[model samples]
Structures are given as structure tokens and as C-alpha cells.
Target: MMYDCNLKIYQTLNVQSEFNIGLLLLYIIEGSSNISINGKTNMYKSNDMIVINDLDHYRILSSKKSVIACLFLSRVELDKFFRFNKKYYINKDKLDLSVLKFYMNKLIVNYVNDQSENEKQNKILEYINQLVMTLHLYRKLDGTIISNNIDVYSGINYMYEHYKEKLYIGKVATQCLLSVRRFSNKLEEVTGMRFNELLRNIRLSYSAFDLMYTKKLISQIANDNGFTNESGFITHFRDKYHITPAKFRKQLENDHYYPFHNKNTTLLRSFEHINDQIKYLTDRDVDYVSIDINMKNKIRSKISTPNLLIYIRDIETLTNNFQQSKLLSMRREIGLFGLLFSHQLFYELYQSNFENNKLVHQMFSFSLEHQFDISFEVKLGKNQNIEEFTLIFKRLLNYLTDCTYFYGQRSFQFYIDASYYQFNRISKIIQDNLKESKVILVLNKQNNYLAKRMSHKVNDNKQIACKVHHEIDSDKDITSILKNNPSLNILYQPNIPNRIESLISIFKWSIAFNQNISMIIDDTWLDSMIPSQSTHLMIKELQLNKESHYQLFELILTLKRLRGDIVYFNGLILMTHYLNEYQIIIFPNMKIFNRLHQRININGFKLGEIEYRHHDILIKNNQLIINSDGDTHQNMAEVSFKREIGKLIVQFYTSPYAIKHIYIKQKIN
Candidate 1:
């Protein structure tokens, strides 16, 4: 029979039925029905769409005069479109039911009109495609159903029931009446994971559910879940979940946790929308050339002029000459102080034939004319050939040196790894060629090459910025790193950029110590590959709440609005007071999740009259209090002036990972 032949419309019905297999789509066009799929029952009314996947045991109880449209596709047919290797259940509630209803109506109309089989099948296929795209299918990690082989089915069921116990594949094979090798092959083929991996995943699923819904300690959860040790559990969890169990639990505690997907769904889906923003930011045609200089200037005028270097690690895109408009748009959207390229990429471009050289020259010329500082980071592997490396490095340096003559002695920054054998030689080259620019040596905590050792080698007239890697997990680590290295100017390389606590702590420390920090805008910041990650500032392209449109935009604006030096920073909170204005950022401490209900009090501010604006902060009776209840996304107040009287003490309670920005100013008398 034709594909469309499987769809049938019932005008009147009084029946209870079960469907053993195939994919089924039912739309209630006229009346309501009580439907139960796989033990759960719900009343589906008119305009409602329901999707039943393969092997679903569904029963339908309908009233007389009820109109229902049913479209069924067999397993053979569904396999042609989707991979049945893994079981998929549609997230019916998460989808836009209206869109599915519209397509369902179209299919029903086409079938009722006695349309040609070709046209009918095409419509059916169209509806199926929409269903697939709109309904983000939830894939279960608890092994695929093996209906054909009773032994395999029994084995899988046994595995599920005893997943918490220490399982050996040989014993499982014996229970299934099969050889060990046969069972292993069958399990891998059906579940896409090996014996140990599959068992661990099954345990993880239960542990994650408990983590989200229960208040059990990490060690207790790990022990109960059959993990050999808490550390092993954490390692496996991070590998699969992309974060520590504590942080994962902490993120769920946040009021902003949307629970947008299934419990089995990874936390990564919450921020998966960020991929769209990244795609938009990076979209470009390779053949497109740069716009005229006047056009570039006009584009800059249309938006807030951004001034921050964008770290681009993908060098091939640059060499391929991906549209300069995309780069310009990035600069327009997020201020690009300049473009930093990997030294290896520059070397490759330098060594390429004359045509590649022209491309490089064109890129540098455009960047220089646009007031973008071009910089490079040279990372040397211990096994690198020094002779070849230096040769290419010098050539790239020569090109930058030449650009300076044209761009009027522009300053250029070079970040050389401490591992480089000729660190001093490279520093000397930068010092002699670019007097105003800086050469920062990147060092880890264990590096024996202290600032003092390097300080004596360089001239006193030359300034060397000390940059150390910030890796340890506590405030004490930051204190020790700074106290021991007084000249440390930059927190060179920070890991786990997505963790809001880590980012906030780094920013707080930088502001407190009057030091500058940097971010490497690479995949770690842009990519959301796992479920256990927290939300960061993501740009929404469409019209959202215009008042709080682009969060990253607001963050950059806040950074620009700081009046003077940051006066107070205690990791969780930061304050900057200068002239007539004060800027303070308050956020909950993730370590002490219990203290979230408590209030924070700050005093000692002299003011004749107060003009204050705040975002997600409650200020009442000279205390900064939490909103008790607020929207998921934090809000931002437009810059305004107002009058207030009484003590300046501020007390506030905050939600997990919710960073609030408040601005207070004294009215000029």
C-alpha cells in the first residue's frame, strides 16, 4: 500500500485500542479523547497533536461524533528517515502544537479530497519532516528495546534492574543463555556503548535524577550509585556532563534553570540557543571582500563602538578570506580592540606563496586603517624545531614591523609562552621593534621562572607584564598567587569560562587588585556541547525584551561606565565608587548555597541626595534585598537620576548565578 493509505480519519468513534508498533501521529480535529501511551494517560482535545513512537503500547478511548486524523508509518518506513539504532521519544509538550496541527489539517484535507497518491504521500512526508524538526526527540540511554530476540530483551531488562550492582558481562551473558562475546557484540550493536560504559551510563541517569530532585551529598550519591570512588564518579560525570556534580546541582538550584528538556536531557540544551548566536556572528561568504573605508566608518557609527580584541583561533578562515563584513559586524556588535591570531597561522601565511602574502597584507591594512591592534600569541612545544620556528617568526614580525611604518608606529602585543627556549630573544625582538607595545610571558603556577628572574634580565626602562595562569579552585589560591607575585599584572589564562562563579571570581579579583584580565573568545566560551553547563551572556537577535535585549551588550556597557577604581570586591560582590557615581555587582556565592536566603548589608557612603538605578536588586529601608521572585533573565535599569533619603546600608539576597548590577549616584547640587 502507498504511504498515504496508512492515514485514516474517523468521523464517529467509541473504542479502546492498542497499537503495538510503528510511528503514529494523531490530531484531534473535532472532539476530545482520553489517550494512554505506555501507562501514562492524558486528555487530548481539539487542535492537539500526539506522537507515538515504535513499540508504544497506546490505548485510545473516544466519544461519539469525535473526529480524529491518524497517520501511521511502520518501522521499516521510519528507519528510512531516522536512525532507529537508538530509541527516540518526541517531547510533545516542548513543540509548538499549533504548527503540527496546521500540517495535520493539510494532510487531512488532501486525503479527504481524494488527491493523487503522489501528492498525498508528499504531504505526509512534509508533515513528518516538520514533526521531526519541531519535536526535539529525547533519546534514552537505557538500552534500545530488542523485541525480536527474547534473550536479548531479557538481558537488557536484567541489566536495567541490576544496573546499581557491580555487573560482569560474562555473568550477564550466562543469564541470557549466550556466550560472552555474543552478548557483548549484541549489546554494542543495540546500545552503541560497551558493557562497562553502558552500565555506568545507566547508573549516571539515576544519579542525575537524584542529583536534581534529591538533597543527597555527592559522596553518598556516588557510593549508592556503585561508583568505585567519588573522584572516579566526578571524572565520569564531568566527561559526560561537562561540570562537577556540585556545580551541576548548584545550577539547578538557580531559579533561572528552565528545565526546557527531559530529565534525561543534558543541561547543555539550556544554552544550546547560543549556537545560533555564534553561527550568526561567524556567518560569512569566503569570496566577499572588505567594504570601502567610508562604509566601514558608517557601520561603526550605527552601533555602540566596541573596543576589545576578539581572539580568533581558526586561522584557516582568515587565510580563506571569509567575508570581512562578518568581522566588521563582530567588531560592531562586540567591541573588537583588535584581532589576535595564533603565531603558527601567521607563520603559515608568511611561508605561503605571494598570493597568500597579498591576502595577509590586505587583512592587516584593513585592520590597521580601522584602528584595530593586530597581535599574535606564540606557543612553543618542547619538541618544536627552533631554527625553523625563529625563521618564520622573524618573517611574521617583519610584516608587522612594516605595517607600523604605514600605520604610524602602532603598538603591537606579543604573548609568548614561558616554554619557549628563546623567550628572552623573542622579547628582545619585540622590545627593539615595538617600544610602546608589551611582551607578556605566559606561565603556569609550577613554572620555576619567576618574575624576579626575568626582571633582572630585561632593562629597567622596559616594562614586562607578568601573566600567570589562574587554575586553582578557591579564593585562597588567588590570594597566594598575587601575594607571592606582587608584579602580576594579568590573570593570563583562565579555564572553564562557562562557569559563572569562576568568571565572576576572576573579574572580582581583577577589579579589587586594580589589574587587567583577558578572555580567549574561543570554543570554550562559544560552544555549548554538554548538558551540565550554566548560562552565560548570550545575544538574542530577535526582538526580546528590548529593555534587556543583549546581556553581553549590557556587560560591556557596565565595564565602560565604571567611573574610577574598583574600591571593594569580596568575590561574591564588587563595588566601584568614584566622583558622583557608584557601580556595584552582587551575586550569590555558589559555595554557600544555603546562605542564598540571607541578606547582604553594606554601609559607609556619604550622600546629600541619592540617585539610584538597579537591576534585579531589592533596596528597601537602606538595605539591598533580593527580589524574592524575579524573571529568569536579569534586568538592567536605564541610566537615570533620582532622589532618596536615609542610611546608605544595602542588604540583598540573590539566586544562583544571578549577577545583579546596581548604579547609585549623588545628585549634583
Candidate 2:
């Protein structure tokens, strides 16, 4: 058997091998270079030696003035010399040349020095034998060589080679001559993962490589890697790399941030970006601006002064409803009463009729289309069993999740009125599922006590916000009741109070404590009113006088300027004048907005010199246009109205700094 071992020096070499010429050994004595085997790239510095088997195609790009030593051995001759049938497998491409440096120098010296040909040949054989034994020992210690013992190492190697196939533990155990349970334990010990986990990881690794290199379709790659579907592949890829395969590939192509290359560093940079944005938005100097209470009180006193009524008489006629009893009788006569015949007939009929009415239907449809909040009511029968309660709660949750998927957006929050036990169960389910959806639970007197008690039992790490509703006179009583309940931060909702002092106190308390205050205005008309620090405002079955209605509009604008919290107006038909100033407004039904516009004076307000740029505005004679830009566009609103009405509403849904000034002109005709 004959093989070649030579010491060669090269200043620079850029070679792409078409075929591997036996086992090629490269020892770099000086300088550094990069080598690419197939598409995998690796760098080798000074004193590094690399062994490339005949099975691989490789390319070597040497740095300037680099020196390298090369040796080549035929597979047949190497097998004959080592007394082994199969070829040698180096665990890694690169190894430290230090161990072989001394022997290599000695061999060169012996060959160069004067000596008999047979003697030199004998020394060469001994040296080559020693090198093979050293590699074998190193391979064993590196855990990269498969042992000949057919039990453990061979079984693992087989799994690694055939992971894409449908593998069963029992079959593999039988092949390894071991019991199924023992094999399972041994597999876990060897891989540090269960059989299924290890198999999935192998497939995932291959898929990742293909994604980085191949131009194959994601579905085809998924199928090739034994994934049931593209979604499964995508889900697992996201879990491992924190991004989808397509996104990863795009990042690689664009030479942008690739998380997988240096995961911890990229993750830290991402967190830093988020932290910077948060700091910019919530800078203490900006968010915590101090407003003098004395000055606020003085301004409030001036604003709350009652003025002579400037009423729109037509609004009353437009919003007036037909006799309810007469409408019900007509429905019964026409045999159109299906659920109306039930015990809670009126409530059901009201909800159904309200939802089906053209204006109401339009409002609901528009809200859904624009991804605004849609409220659903769930009423529990008296004294229901736990199982029945849990089922209803679960159904409600499922509906919320379905809504999130259907809308293809997640800006909406769910509002539910539940008992203490029901809220407990719902909270547990939310925590277990790790849902990101927000839920606002409305509490009344009956369950408020139990909620406070359960607050103490909750985990401190858990986040919970409670809104408590109570009568105006019971402010001190409610405060005392909640004194011991430090675990829950309570927000108060007192029914609309008559005095301005009470309103100011409530608003100040809300701001001071970072809690919400709520008010329900039900038919009581006050002479003067101002905005409070209330998170929610529910007007229940109430119609205000024209002057009072105008005051409420002013209150809405003031609240918008103050906290910027979402205010929900339930069971109230807001006038067009009230709707003009808001960026986003939601109504219970479309009919309410329609009715408000029926006798609406286009001359209701003055028009401004409008500039229409982009797809931001549209005007149709008497109607107000509202639109959302599909799912990808968020926090945006586009509205326009004709100048014939002399009224113009300019609502900009962007950062405050981007707001444009409007030029108003009084109506001419």
C-alpha cells in the first residue's frame, strides 16, 4: 500500500474542489483563511489543521501570504494500513495542529536527512499508524464516533440517519435488543430529550438549513422535513427562532438583524428598542405634568356657569320613537313575535329590534369593520350550578377568541358583568392560557364584597384592576369597606352628582390614585356640567335637554383632552354635534347616528378650509364618511362632510405632534 505525505507552502490559494481526492489533510502553520464545505462556512486561524473526507466537496480561500502543509492518502491504502474496512470520520473539520506539529517536523527531518530507502519507509509506516490511532482516540473522547457495540451508539446513529422516517420506539428497541421502557430511558439519556422531541428537532434543524440556503417553497420544505403541514413547521420554527421561516429568510437576504446568528445579542437589542420607545412616550416629565388644583378649580367654576339655552328643537322630533306598546301589538298581529313571546319578552324584543334596525345594524357593522369595541351581554339565571356557570363562562371566552381571529385584529377589550366565583374561574382560565386579551369586569353591590375578599387570596404577581360602583353618599362607606383590601386597586363610580365640588373631588381622586371613576347619567338634567376623570360613562335610558346635551358634548371633549381613556356610552343616542369632535366614537346602534342626522342642520357648525390629501377624507352631501384601512392599518380614522351644511369635523388619528390646524369659515347661505 502506498500514500503521499508532502510539506508544501503557498502564498495564496483559492480552490474549489470538483471531487474529493481521498482523505486530504491541511495544516495551516501561519496566517488565517475561510473554508466552505457545501454551503456551511467556517473560519480557520493559525496553527489549525483540518481533515476533509472523500465524501465532501469543499472550497478553500486563503488569506494573503498564508502558509499551508498538505497530505493525501488513498482510502484503500488507509483502510489496509489501519486494518479497518470503513473509512475514517473526523469528528470536526478543524483540529489543533499543535499535537501533530512535533511528529510532523521529525518525519520531514528523517525523510530529508541521508538514510536508506527501506529505513525511511519503515519510519513512515510507524508514523502513519500512530497518527491513525491518535485520531481514533480523539474521536472517542469527542463523543463524535459511533461505537461498534450494536446496542447504544449504533441505535443513536441509526436514529440520526433516519429521523425523517416514521420511527417507533418499540421497533428501535427490538433492533437494539432491549426492552421498550429501557430503550426509552436510554434514548432520553443519550439525547437529553424524548424520542419525539429529538426527532422533531432533527427535522427542524434540516428545515432551518434549507430555509437559509434553498429557494424551495415553504410548504415543500415542510413536507420534505416530515412536518404534517406548513403551519406546524412555521409554529415550531417560530418557537425555536422567535420568528417564522419566511421572516428569517427575508432577514438573511436583506442582511438585517438575524436572531438565530447571535440570539442573546439580538434579543437584547430588541428589548433596548422597546425600552427606548417606552421611555420616549412615558417620560416622567411629560406624563407627570403637574396641574395646579387652584387654577383648575377656577377654570372649572368659569366653565360650569349656566348660559341661556341654545337648543336644536328639530333633534327631539327626529329622535322621538313610535309608541312601544303600539309597535309590540303590530308585531304580535303580524305573527313576527318569535322570542318576543318568552318571559323576558320585552328585554329580548328590545335587544333584537334594536340590533335589527337599519341605523343600529349599520353602527354594529361599522364598529365590527373598524375593529372597535363590541359589547355583548351574558345574563345568568338566579342560583345556577357551578358546572352551568363554568360552561357559560367558557363559551363567552371562546366567543372572545373567535372575535379576535375573525376581526384579524386585537385592539378590542371584553366587558363582562360576572359574580365573584365566575370572575375567579375566568381569571384562572385566562392565566392558564396566557391570553393577551384585556377584560374589564363590572362589579355591583351583590358581588363587590366577595371580590374584595378574593383579592386578598390572589397572587401578588398577578395583575388585576377592579372598578367598583356605588351610590354618591356611600363614598366614605365604600372607602372603609375597601380599606383592608390592599391587594385590589379600587376605582369608584358614583351616579351623576349635582354639585360641582363633588365632581372635582372625584376627578382629582381618580388622577391622584391612577384609578378610574365612572358616572351613569339617567334622565337627570343638570344646569351646569364639566368633564370628570372618569374612564367610563354609561347613560342608561336617558334623554337630556338640548342645553344639557350640549354640555355633555363639551364634557366629552374635555375628557378627551384630559385622560384619553375610552368612554363607553351605553343606551344613549348621541347627537351629531356631540359626535363631531371625537376621533373615534361608538354607538349602541346605527339608528342613533342616523336619527341624529335626520333633521341635523348642515349649518349646525361652521366649516373649515379643508385640505384633502392621501386617502384620509371623503365628503357626501349630508352624510359623514367613516372608514378603516383594512387589518394592517391601525389607530387611524378618515372622515369628511360637505361644506353645504357649514359644519366640518376634522379628526386626525395620529400623534399629537402631527395635528394640523384648521381654518374655519362661517356659513354663507
Candidate number achieving the greatest TM-score relative to the actual structure: 1
Task: Give the alpha carbon lDDT tens digit for every residue of 327-445 in model 1.
Answer: 55556545544677766565566567633556666667777887877667777766777677777776666667777788885687777765535666777776776677777766644
The TM-score measured for candidate 1 stands at 0.44
lDDT of each: 0.54, 0.43
In order, how many clashes per candidate? 12, 5
Q: Tell me each candidate's TM-score.
A: 0.44, 0.26
Question: After superposition, which runs of candidate 1 have C-alpha atoms over 4 Å from their true positions?
Answer: 1-308, 315-336, 354-356, 456-481, 491-497, 511-514, 523-560, 590-606, 616-646, 649-653, 667-669
Candidate 2 achieves a global lDDT of 0.43
Estimate the TM-score for candidate 2.
Answer: 0.26
How far is 5's C-alpha from truth in model 2 (Å)? Answer: 99
* Superposed Cα deviation of residue 63, candidate 2 (Å): 99
